[model samples]
Target: MIKLQNVEKVYRTSSIETLALNNINLDVKKKEFISIMGPSGCGKSTLLNIMGLLDAPSKGQIEIDGSKVENYNDKDLAHLRNQKLGFIFQSFHLINDLSVIDNVEIPLLYRSSTAKQRRDLAQEALEKVGLSNRMKHFPKQLSGGQKQRVAIARAIVGKPEIILADEPTGNLDSVMGNEILGILQKLNEDGATIVMVTHDDAMAKKTHRLVRLFDGTQVM
Candidate 1:
């Protein structure tokens, strides 16, 4: 349930201007799993950031669930993102000192939920990622696969409608990457819309559709 119309992103300095995305018009339907693939500097991540509301377009419109987001203030965008989106990054952005469950609970801290509610929700999310038994362990104690699973748990702890994954498997071995892909597949089947940016062709092939970018333009 996301749409971008004639979107463009540009980074400007006193000496030069660079266009990151050019005339991007995309629509992602509910529960659709989309893969965005491109070479480095081809705007895949930029497009994902705009879709995730992590960044804004220099020009054009963005709509989430039929609501225009182009005019939203930062506070409103943050509220909307917290309520509607989840993010999975390749680096597994977990706090080194926090236990698995504690990391998952971080997102709920912004919501109006009780500690107990947050704990329960975090537990459920961990269970979904098969990490329930590791809840008390610190990130350093986990394997690469387990750490990525922890990241997945944290993302879904908020029960977001859409999941934006930026190279979720980039840091893992092939087998572990496959495991993460299976987890994402199951999430999509269970009704979460997923838009992933990946450099791996094999990973991209697993999604419902592939959208390729080149030189900041949609090539396929």
Candidate 2:
């Protein structure tokens, strides 16, 4: 469902040029679970951003669900992202002021769905993550695991085809991290393509395949 060919990402300022990714070639099939493992500065997050269309590569081509996205217009890219991709971040990224249900509904607000439809979809998503009981709670009112579950619910609420998760368990304790991983595994079993960037070797081993990176290049 995703493809990258000879991708290169470079950040350039007046006096500095840093290569974030170099000659990267990757392909993720539909419904597959893939993990990216690398040390700091190895571009795992950069690759995830590129895959999610949050960032563009300096060179090379990206194709998502058979559509070339390297040069897609902003509106087109946003629409594509909304319709095909979901994101989970280490920080949870939930709105502190909104209830969990509202946070999950935020993405749907951009679509043409009615308020009722959004609520239904959001509720279903929360149920999938086992967070239905916490729907009315704010971010600060929930435990770290619960907050991450809410974030996962928010990501999947739109029924996107792929999920890009960056350091999903980075901030959690081992127990909570394992709980989060279990939720991700269940989501993958339900056929959501997941590409996760993680520094934990044990976590990487749990995925179907691992892509190792170093010095901004895929080494395995």
| Candidate 1 lDDT tens digits, 45-119 | 899999999999999999998889977999999999999999999899999999999999999999999999999
lDDT of 2 at 121: 99
What digit string (tens of lDDT, one per residue) describes model 2 on residues 157-207? 999999999999999999999999999999999999999999788988999
Q: How close to the true structure is residue 209 of candidate 1, measured as C-alpha lDDT?
A: 95
Candidate 2 ranges with C-alpha deviation above 4 Å:
none
For model 1, state the Cα shift of residue 91 in Å.
0.5
Clash list (residue pairs), candidate 1: none
CA-lDDT, candidates in order: 0.95, 0.95
RMSD of 2: 0.7
Clashes of 2: 0
